[model samples]
Target: MPKSKRNKQVTLSKTTKKGRGHKELIINGIRDAAEKYSSIYVFNFQNMRNSKLKEFREQLQSSSKFFLGSNKVMQVAIGRSSSDEIKPNLHKVSKLLRGDAGMIFTNLSKEEVERLFNEFEGYDFARTGSIATEKVELKEGPLEQFTHDMEPFLRRQGMPVRLNKGVVELVSDFVVCEEGKPLSPEASRILRLMGNMMATFRLNLVCRWGSEDDFELYIDGPGDSDVE
Candidate 1:
């Protein structure tokens, strides 16, 4: 070979940097929503599920806009102090933006927001490392739920399974998961195969601020002077 081009130089150019402009966009979006809507609520989530959230968003797209991302950026959008806040008393809501939380800018009444948040809950499969809510055991008998071809897969997932008479059977009683224990990767897979759902996704409101007088909803949230 005459000239080798194995290590050819490749220059990559783009209009926007990784995180620089995105942060500005988020700040602008929150600030804009603050003016577009009458109230702002800080809500925290447990076991967040993006698909479920997407569905909720669609349902509220007509009256509300949700923002979830960097808490720092969101705090900045609403202002961390009274002096710089885009709207009056919004800084108080900003203080409650810590942890797995997001903001909802909506024109709906306060009662409506509270009722919807209280009622919405999504159940999904528990992932690895999530605590098991209940015990799941497979009896030592034919596993009619699984096909014969799934024998190897079941075995690889730590199930004591065998193919007997063209049926999948467990050689011994197997405890797939135990209550109050962190689920292993194998245990999570087995639970999904058995159609067990353990994770619950829900949103709890922290505080609200906007055109109306600011008030706190959840006192257990992190913040200063009952604001967080």
Candidate 2:
């Protein structure tokens, strides 16, 4: 089967309804991170890769920390209002905790942090429900990429393929995937077999806060415009 976002495991700490203590642990961790680091940022995480995120965390372990959990729990930890605020003006940071978001705390300078985020993005094969950035149409011809024995497998994926003289051949021009439409399970597999990569995974900055400054929103994102 083709890998897809549907199978991606999110890192946000999950807990049972009775495990409220887990929520408390996340809250305390967020508070500690806020106090320990000089600069704090809230980021919107969409279809973030778990393995790449682990690599990213390990790469920045010397000077940065990332915390992701339930949005409501984080909001409570940071304080959505002035009454239970964790730090001075932390409520500003809390406001950006909407959607699938997380916090990144770092001692690095703003310039260096921006550079790190820009350089740290990773790419992966587009999966099911992912849109094709470009059109991939295979003309009627021999497809030596597949072995002769794999003829049945190729045909099962909706390809009009046949083994001719121990070579897979497309009987007609096959539109594997069209631009801007969701790639089907079979199409995703075909795209990867054809070496087409369309998904660029990267984080987006929602807001940043510092001890001396107020939280601010950034529309530019984490410097990855190739993402859908």
Local distance difference test values of all predictions, in order = 0.88, 0.82
Identify the leading candidate in terms of lDDT: 1
User: Residues 153-214, candidate 1, lDDT per residue (tens digit)?
Assistant: 99999888889999999999999989999999999998888889999999988877755366
User: Taking the tens digit of each residue's C-alpha lDDT, what string does model 2 give over 65-138?
Assistant: 99887889989988888777877778767766777788899999888877877776777888899888888999
Full-model lDDT, candidate 1: 0.88
Candidate 2 residues lying further than 4 Å off, grouped into runs, are 1-18, 220-228
- Against the true structure, whose TM-score is highest? 1
Question: Each model's TM-score, in the order given?
Answer: 0.90, 0.85
